[model samples]
Target: MRADRLVSLVLLLRQRGRLSAATLARELEVSTRTVLRDIEALSAAGVPVYAERGRHGGFALLPGFQTELTGLNHDEALALLVAGSRRGAQVFGLGSALASAMLKVVDALPESYRNTAAGAAQRLLIDPETDLLARRSVAEEVPDTIVAEVRRAVFAGHKLRIRYAAADQAPKWRTVDPIGLVTARDQGYLLATRSGADRTYRLSRISAAQELAEPAQRPERVDLDRAWQERSARFRTGGDQVTVSVRVDPARRAHLVDTALTIGAEEPEVDGWLRLEAVFQDPRHAEWAVWQLATHAEVLAPQWLRASLRERATTLATRYDVPPGESRPSRASAAATSAATRTPDSTAPSK
Candidate 1:
């Protein structure tokens, strides 16, 4: 830890030129005494660190002294900086570590590339709270201790015991052998197995976690990417997957697949519409996705899904009190019906 702090301190000096002892202490979250000792240690090790007297002065690397972190070109340094700017690392409790690492990378770059890399990275934006369309993609928060425990079990090939608050279920204790950890957006997941059954636990939902003493019952060598893909495929195809064959208008055909759990085979009909075999999360999911598209999308099969949609539509139709046998009107139909229902006298001034 001291070595990490010392490296971070050097990077700060390399990036900002000279910095005061108090500044170093504040940046490193250490004391001025520690900073002084590190400076002395650097000098003893022939690192060319020197102190300057007077209020405007502090510790600095001698002119032209730069750490040799080579084989990295300008683009690589910029990429590293931009990546460091993201909060994905923060979700796993690596925010401070990422910052320190980024500092070392920038400091190690060749002098000619360092400033350009820094400036170029500052121009790119990622994962802003509100995106370009002003829509907030809210982030999930996980406790530091929970993620640290989960990460430890994953990387160290150990089992983990967790108190998890599963969605729609009461909090319960579970012991699992962690396979890997995955982060998407700002949320993290623990991909693990219990009794050889694959399970995924959202890291944020873990109220408490502890690394188990027993070694994990897992393969010695794992291809995490392959394991994740296999788990995902199983999850998508095995869960309460509902298949809904649908006839969707051309305009809504693309939209249908956008919201589906899986898009199966599709065929274009002679009527200019496409009949698609769409897989949805469940009946409720099928109903919700189709209903949003209204008459533009029609559920054609898997009687249960069709029935569910019809039930909701019938209820919706009743809510509006349209005469029985009068079909629900879409936007265009409603406009035409509105015109047909009115008389010329209705628009004329009364005598």
Candidate 2:
């Protein structure tokens, strides 16, 4: 670990030219004393590292000194820099390692490609946590310790025990043969097996985890993608799935399709709308998804869903309805009322 840190320290100096001990410590997540010690170690190893004096002083490497680690070309280096900017590392508790690796990648690039690649990567954004509608995407929070243990078990091919709280159920401890971890749409899942039966657990639902001493009872090699797909197929076909017929505005048809588990048949309506049969996880899921489209979507069949939506809409409308003389005040009227109610002292600036 110290060797990695020492190499990182040297790479930092090589990339950034001059950096104060405090800055190095902050970047490397260590003490200023550790940074100083690293500097001494680098100097003793015959690397031409020296310090500048005064308030604007720091450590720097000799001019023209570079490491022979340039194995990536221009596009390759840029791709890596951009990928390192993603949030997957944080999901797997590898954020620190990723940061260190990114530093090394940048430092290892040829001098001509380094700055441009880094700058270009900064210009691109990936998987932002919010959309243009200002709706924030909430990522499930998994405790770092829990994720670390789970990750260890998966990589080391050991059994894992977890106290998991499934939806609408009490937390229960279960032991599973760890298969692998997967992250999709900012959510983490552990694909494992219990009693030789495939099981998937959401990492956020895991309150606690322990890596067992026993090796996992699983195959030597696994195709995780195929496993997940098989499980998903079974889940979709086995659940209390509800099929609904709906007519959606042409513009919102894509939105409706995106939320459904599957679409059976789609045809254009006479009024330029689209009529389609969509399947959802359940009736409640069907109702909620159709409700999101507001007036742009209408439930055709599944009379119960239509009734439920009507009841909900009526309730909401009644809640916001006003009587004959109790209309909401306009903004201008409210502003005037506020001015009229204010006293001279209330409006005056404080001394």
- Residue-level lDDT for 87 in candidate 1: 70
Lowest-scoring 10 consecutive residues by lDDT in candidate 1? 70-79
TM-score of each: 0.67, 0.75
Residue-wise C-alpha lDDT for candidate 1, range 217-331, written one tens digit per residue: 8888778778778877877777677888889999887888888978889899999999998998776778889999998988778887788878788767655888767777676
lDDT of 2 by residue, 1-108 (tens): 687788778888888889999999999989999999999998998889999998989999999887754344432343354364356656666656666667877876
**Model 2: per-residue Cα lDDT at residue 144:** 84
| Number of residue pairs clashing in candidate 1, backbone atoms closer than 3 angstroms, sequence gap of 3 or more or interchain | 0
* Most TM-score-accurate candidate: 2
Candidate 1 residue spans exceeding 4 A from truth? 1-10, 17-85, 123-131, 269-271, 300-351
Count residue pairs with overlapping backbones in model 2.
0
- Candidate 2 lands at a TM-score of 0.75
Q: What lDDT does model 2 reach?
A: 0.84
Clashing pairs in 1: none
Q: Indicate the TM-score of model 1.
A: 0.67
